[model samples]
Target: MLDDATLRQLSKTRGQTLERLRGVFNAGVGGDRIENMLYRLIGNKDGSRDLQGLAEVLQGRNVKLWVVSAGTNNLQKKKGLVDADVDKMRLLLDTLLKISSRTTKMLFSGLTYRTDIGDQLVDEANEKVCLLIMAMNQEFGYARIEYLPPVADLDKGQHLADHVHLNERGYQMWAEILAPRVMELYGS
Candidate 1:
């Protein structure tokens, strides 16, 4: 979990700024406008949020949000967590329970095939994070939860980069699997 300060700091790093700008621009388009809506829907496949709109939704739903992603390092360092991280995760989960209007639902994922140890580490970490999400869902009595598994053949050169993040094809596969489950669980 990154502090707001930390996320801001990370945003200043070269690539992260571009990523955040892209996130902002992509999330800004409304869903009612045909062209913009299609663009936003395509871009939001991996669960993009307009921070302002998301905050509004949280207010509307009376829910607080927390997301945990599996990065490459989280895998290799399994069972070697720092106490600070453990505490932060616990606090974040607890806060979600306390703040959310309805019961919470956690979204998590497993490790994927990767080209490098770093990617593998992210995969490993994500696996652990997923487990933690499950435990939290149970512990806090979430209304619902879901786990997205790694694509089996993803490492076969279908991915664009380090094989950690997904390409559009990978995202589509992900959305197809996830959207239905989320709809079933939350009634979409």
Candidate 2:
């Protein structure tokens, strides 16, 4: 999960600096792709569970926010798969939106710069990822969905050490930026 402790830390800071808010929930899994997430949602695998299952599990829990950081794994191929991936993502988002209360807010983190895997195919794939983000924001509107840009110049080593995953500093920066927005949405 890209150092979600940073997010927890950010939430803690928010409670200290602002209001006494509940802690953050870290439901992220490492190396999770969009397709894999769909599989998990439907319980297609032995140990995986679908979104309905997840909702059932968290039936009584107070879930006020959801932050999604996916689609980077879908960017290793060509442009042909972009539409399919976007469609799947839209379905996933729609399902989540339907399940959540109107007060719940969602944030989608955009794919960062990939400098290590500098192939033509990867570049094309990144372009598609950006397009997917744009389309989702345009279609859903800010009231329902918001997009978080990469923490820093991802091409630089400080933000993304491996070109794909966020470094420690990157995570901290990301959490710092996102915490305020989360507060705004949650408080409203």
Candidate 3:
């Protein structure tokens, strides 16, 4: 999750004031999957109590950058439907791109390794995610959409406590890695 403190720190580091806009609907629902997100986006389901959909949130707003971090929950699903997941992800990205302005920069965070899950399953899911990133970059072009790599040492236990979620130090490290790229894009 992109915390407020990290965004504030990023603003200070970049010497540019940045506003945080959030549109989260379902929170802490283990059953939340990519299909659910797609349905929410299409107005089939209520995405949030306030924000209707992702495009609706962006509509009439001054958005310069969009960062999306999803697919982990989808990958964690028991039934492995990598292709379906990737297709849904592509549709989401395409929808976002259509709704976003031409100058809006987009960043897609890649899947991180989960230690709590089976090693082979995690590896396979990450591989599919990497492929999805590659395909998205090719379709969107490198200049418009960028793929942020997973944290280098997720297995080291210093950053992650549950192996699924990040601890305070992990969040700090994530901010450190993400803020600079955001700054660079803002500057450009």
Candidate 4:
């Protein structure tokens, strides 16, 4: 139901209806909020971290902090758990550390919950992700690597806008959960 093909088909079928209601009930009326939410809804780690400018940006001496908070969609794609998935993540982490400046401090948060993945599997998969973080921390001991456990409670409907992407309150709550860690590393 949450696949790209499905979304494209829905857009095709519903395009006329959306156009008809554009003046009265347009999502873009407010901003790109709805459009951004939809993109994040289908955001999976199919081939994440293309690393287009990763090395270039982090190579700078002033690039001190790298806060990475993503990977819930990996679970949607049945990733971040299996052996192959672990291998790929580890490689990415390793590359990230290697390409980054020596002084770069990384705060890597674990996976958040997806409505599609059951709670049990989410926990287990996030545990695997945590292990990868730990391994990267061990290997890249020169730089600080802080790992926070998975973001919880997203399965609860209040935080979700469409049982998929987070709403305003949901994003605020996520920021609240990470504010302390960000402040700790980033300072006031």
RMSD of each: 13.0, 4.9, 5.5, 12.3
Across 81-171, the per-residue lDDT of candidate 2 in tens digits comes to 3678878877666655666676667777666555654445554554665666567667766566666665544435666657566665665
The 10-residue segment of model 4 with minimum total lDDT is 21-30
Model 2: per-residue Cα lDDT at residue 83? 71
lDDT of each: 0.43, 0.60, 0.62, 0.51
Maximum-lDDT candidate: 3
What's the CA RMSD of model 4 in angstroms? 12.3
TM-scores for all candidates: the values are 0.49, 0.68, 0.69, 0.62
Residue-wise lDDT of candidate 4 within 79-133, one digit each (tens)? 3356665665565555556655676677776655656666777688777777777
Q: Evaluate residue 43 in candidate 2 and report its C-alpha lDDT on the 0 to 100 scale.
A: 41
Off by over 4 Å in 3: 1-32, 45-52, 60-62, 77-81, 140-142
User: How badly does each model clash, as a count of residue pairs?
Assistant: 10, 1, 0, 0
Candidate order by lDDT, decreasing, is: 3, 2, 4, 1
After superposing all C-alphas onto the true structure, candidate 3 shows an RMSD in angstroms of 5.5
The most accurate candidate by TM-score is 3
Inter-residue clash pairs, candidate 4: none
Which 10 successive residues of model 2 have the least lDDT summed?
11-20
Task: Report how far off residue 3 is in candidate 4 (Å).
Answer: 19
Q: Where in model 4 is the C-alpha error above 4 Å? A: 1-52, 76-80
